[model samples]
Target: MHAGRDASDTLAALLADWQRARTPYRADAHDELAAVLVLAGSNADVERLNLAARAIRRQAGELTGPDRLYRLPGGRTLALAVGDHVRIRTNDYRARKSKGARADVLNGYRGTVVAIEADRSVIVQWRRPGADGPALATEKVSAVYIAVGGLSHGTAMTVAAAQGLTADRMLVYGMGLDPHTPYAAMTRDRLSAHLYLPRNVLESDADRARHSAPRNGAEELHRALNAYAAILQGDRADQLISPEPEPIAAVRARQREAAEQAEVQKMAQAVFAAAMLETVTDPRRPHGLLGDDQLQERISAAAAQTTALAKVVEVEQRRERQQAEQVTAVRAQVHAELAGERDRLATALTALDDAAHRHDAAQDRLRTAQRKVTALEATLHERYGGRIRGWLPSGERARLTEQLQQAKEKLTCAARRAEAAGRAEQAALRQAVEVFPAAPSAAELHQRLRVLANPRTFASALEKESAARVEAVLPGLADQRRVRAARMASPGLGDSAADRQHRARQALAALTAEADYRHRLDATRQRGEERARRDPAAPALARSRHEQAQQQAETRRRAREQQRGYRPSTPPGITAEGPRQGYGR
Candidate 1:
């Protein structure tokens, strides 16, 4: 067989095998043999055959037309028809370092240009194929070449290169028009250049160099050459040489200026007539000119008028000074009145505070005296039986009983005085509020109210706090009393009557100490309740908080009892001697 026929048979058999198997064909396979078969027939020389094969290889893997055959980079043959399912395989490879410390492939993931990085790599992002929704992924690669077919939106290229690229539309963002980037991103069918100039981008020296006068001159020369060619082709001699006529509108502007000048002259004539009419007919002179004697008389009259005006100005100045003095006196008087009012208000508040302090002191004394009297009575009963009046001879028991009675009476009188003083202080405060109105401060009013208002609530809180303190200390006092009573009962210990009396005195001192504790607790709680009522937005909330504190104290007491392995015999707020009589009212 002939060599050309044998090559043809091999090519034909390879094409049939590629058709049977569904795969894409790559171009670099058997390049020399394919060139021989392609250049075999017709008068096509070797050079033309080489060019044809190069052109065919250039479009090997691209989508050219419907139902066309394409060869991918892998060695396979496949049909690239419409509605064909194509899969792109992405391999994650480690970067290979070059001699210049540059990466040949920074990343291989396919995507659009998300950013142009500082390291001269372009960040590309695109959706993963067959993903749910528009799921995106990014890769950083060299900005020299971009595969734009994979991106959903358009990508941006930083460098300007115009070869081996195709697009439908292009946009230049934050950059001026460069000579090459515009052509690189333009579509062959229809190209529209859209420029977006952000604050970071400005026309630089390189842009001016590409768009200078010499470049514009070259472009104009081309346009002139085209026009001359068109003229030679057309044969119209007069049309090319005719000069354009001057526009009539420009000549029409001078007529308007002339009319404006005429109107100004007419206005001048009218002003001259008005001046002639204002002038008086000078019978002594032929022309309208003033004489030297008349001019001197006019000047003297003007001087007389000026002197009278100066006198009126002096009179006005004197009146203004008197008014200013009156204003100053009125301002000082108002300030003095305000100062006097402030001082008076301060004095009244101080007096009210003093009265309140006296009232509180009187109440404290009365409670203390009452507790003392109660303690003395208990002591008397503990020392003596029903024969208390006859137990002591030297009139000592009678004197002690009389003193207790007097203390009770004094407590009663003190309570009455305290009540009266509280009422008087409250009345004075109300009168001040009515008389002063706006003169008193809110703080002052709040103080007065805490001291003088809601006496019942204050009295109730005081009673409860006092009762709690007494209840807390009562068990210890009762235990001491029990021990003393046991000692008295068991005389077998060989104790004397004086010793028993001394023990009784100690018990009485304990009772006094308990009473003192209760009094001090009441005073502390009273101040807390008063402040709570004065400042808080909700007084009831303050009261509840106080109750919580009381509950917490009770819990701690119970916890101590539990720790000591002793069950509490009495409920909270209840003493062993039962609730104190005449309390909580």
Candidate 2:
């Protein structure tokens, strides 16, 4: 009796019984816990609905302070009187998930009952709105929030059959707007009914129409009520009441207006599509759209652009042509200058080659002259002690001066002969150059001939000087040889022991006589001195003569001692008369 039927009337009867049999269970308590009505919906929609409920709770000062009101998606809020006995309960779907130990996909909301119905369904209002747009639109209607199966705008009872439980007011959703038994049962027994639906009504209708296809007797009742309501609000209500046809012109005008509206709608759709296309393709021309007319205009503009580019290209080509002509003239002038420079360089190269050849020939001649000079110097140095220096006696100096003068004269003659030979060599070289194609310059030929002549002149000078030096040195050589011969011929050079003995005896005799004479002189001097002292008046002139004679005698003795090389004493083993000749021999 309770499973598939409207449970409102059965629940009402039970509630009345419970009130009648009310017991004093809480005798010491003044208040009881209120039950919160919980609704279920899609997870995201339910979360947003929970947020709206929080907002409304803040605005309305928390209608259900401790108990909550969870108004989920496909569910709405209904404002009720303060005195109405409201209740809140946990949603059956959430309770099942909590029992299974799974996370709640939908949250619970607090609700209060404002009205009751013959069925068990109740009109529940919460603390907040389920969505922002509807909540804002009817936000001013602070005391009148409605719960329906659809959006807040003209909420309807669509899922009356699936409502199952009876409440104070209709709370149906997830069904179509077709004539169905569940929809009739939902709205028929209730005093005030509210419906909850999706954001788009037509989509909801399409979705639920299939499920509501099983119609019943409620379909005839619904059609009758719709006819009655249409007539009461219809535009031709007067004509319908009187039964007459409308004028032909008026019918046609109405048709025309409908057609005009359809055309306007088509044009608006096209404009919106173009605006969307431009938003994606061209931000600068947000309102521009591509069409046949626009494409034609763009083509014409592109043609003009092409023509402008062609004109620019033509101008550039003309300027390039003038530049080319100027370049050609400059190139011709540069070529002429380069030709003259090349000829000058060729002549300079020829002059350099000629100078190099002349320098080589001169170097060869100078080396030959230096070699000849070195050889002649070595020969003269070996023979004559060339370039004489240091202490020469007067006779040798005079000889050297005469010899040097003669050498100078000889050198002059040799130089003349060398000059003649050089002239002949120069003539031969000139003849050779004449035979060749490129004859050397006169200056170059003369310089080479001078180089060749230097060696011969230097050699001749060396020979003359060597001869002069030999002549100057010859007299000194003759004097040294004569002195050597005289020393060899002396007879004393061969004297032996007998001659030495005879000389010694003679020296001894001379020494004895000198001693006797010296003694006699000393006696005479002493006697004279005694006589002078005795006759103090002797003549000064006589004294001077006597002193002079004493000095003369001393000088003579020294002379005789120097002439004989022996002392007064004879050497050992020699007799005073002489040495014995045959003693050793």
Candidate 3:
């Protein structure tokens, strides 16, 4: 037994040496398995070497990379790499008999393949089909395992026969009774308690012992060859056979530190050389009068000057700080004062604007009133005119027509006198008379008279009337007609013919000679009332002092607004210190 063991050891060593010396079939398969083991054992180099050996034995194949394909039982095809292990199954039928019991048939069992398929399907041959039959005919059947290259005819049947034995029988009589198989089954939780029965109750141990004996003929031969092949390939070799060397990180670190130290020493030498060169080339002699004593004296003087300059600078800085504070305080006060002034001015400006608006509104109202008066005069003229009188109310039309007829008679008598003077005078008189024909009513006559008295001729008419010239006579005659209109409008006046004539003459004089006749008329009436306060014999004023005061206030408000002063605040761009803050700190 010892010699046989030595021979087996020698054979294993030779096989390992031969496997190591063999040429690789696929370079890509070698690389892939090397990479997988290297990654799987990153922590320890020794573990990596062991893993590499296992990967080489486990993954050796004729095909490279993942080029090979394997079809699984579920009808799905998968791309396979050299090291990929897969399960293959084939059906096996067997016939067996027990003493005084009917024979039984088993069918379609499972097994692992040793090599690739030789045909489209694994050829499964049945041993027997009936309870009482002899050994069955060897008929090849199609299945997943096929009749692969390395397996023999009866080798598959022998593996199937091993599944019938009890645990003790398998241990005593099996060709390879691996105790690790039960441990492995237990580790995987697949060992059933029923398979481990007591020896006396069922003779299970004896039966298994008889059944576990090694097979004869081709089955034994095929298993021997498979075992020999596995040993040659180093597939089941011991794990602690190879070891790896330690990493070189510490040596690399020392080399890097030494290089850094050398660089630092070189830099130090260059600095020392530069210092020695500077010392030799320096212009100032160390022992010269200007070098030691004079330099010391200069340094002392410089120190004293620095002290004095520092004091001066300190004083200037203090002054500047005080000035800055004062400037800040003044700026704050100025800002407050400016703010107050701005607010006050804004309020005053608002008030001024309101007053100006009120003044404009009052002027607009006065203009509107004048326009309304002009339109009323035009309407009255149309109502009083002979043909256009049809547009007016019957009562007002009759009254206006009577007044117009009287005014036309007076104008005709004045025109005839002017005609007796001369042809040129008559022509002028006739032209004036044409403006004063027999108007349809009194309002029409008043409109014609207003048109004839051109507002632009105020100065010339006043000059002529003051001198009692003949040119003013025509204007004076129109004035007398207006005086009669006023007297007729008054409700409670009963005077003698001479008094009425005198009042009429006074009104004509007021109209012809005054430059601002309307203003003079108002003033004269006021003066007459004042006089009548003492004499009780004159008319009252035409306009009130309240109306005059309101007009004067409105005019003053408009003038103030025109002279108003207001300015908006300064924008961001143009300031005292420029726009430097936008760029710098």
Best by lDDT: 1
What is the per-residue lDDT of model 2 for residues 154-220, given as tens digits with 9 covering 90 to 100? 1111132124433333333212233334345444322333333322222224433544532543543
- Give per-model TM-scores: 0.21, 0.20, 0.20
Q: What are the runs in model 2 whose C-alpha is more than 4 Å off?
A: 1-320, 331-347, 377-585
| lDDT (tens digit, per residue) of candidate 1 on 361-424 | 8889888988989887886676554675445664656776888899889888888988988886
Q: What is the number of residue pairs that collide in model 2?
A: 38
Candidate 2 overall lDDT versus native: 0.37
Candidate 3, residues 436-457: lDDT per residue as tens digits? 3454433453444443344445
Give the clashing pairs for model 3.
122-146, 169-209, 384-440, 384-441, 400-441, 400-442
Which model, 1 or 3, shows the larger TM-score?
1
What Cα-based lDDT does every candidate model obtain? 0.40, 0.37, 0.36
Candidate 3 segments exceeding 4 Å error: 1-291, 385-394, 397-585
Give model 2's TM-score versus the native structure.
Answer: 0.20
Q: In candidate 3, where is summed lDDT lowest over 10 consecutive residues?
A: 34-43
Query: How many clashes in each structure?
Result: 7, 38, 6
TM-score, prediction 1: 0.21
Most accurate candidate by TM-score: 1
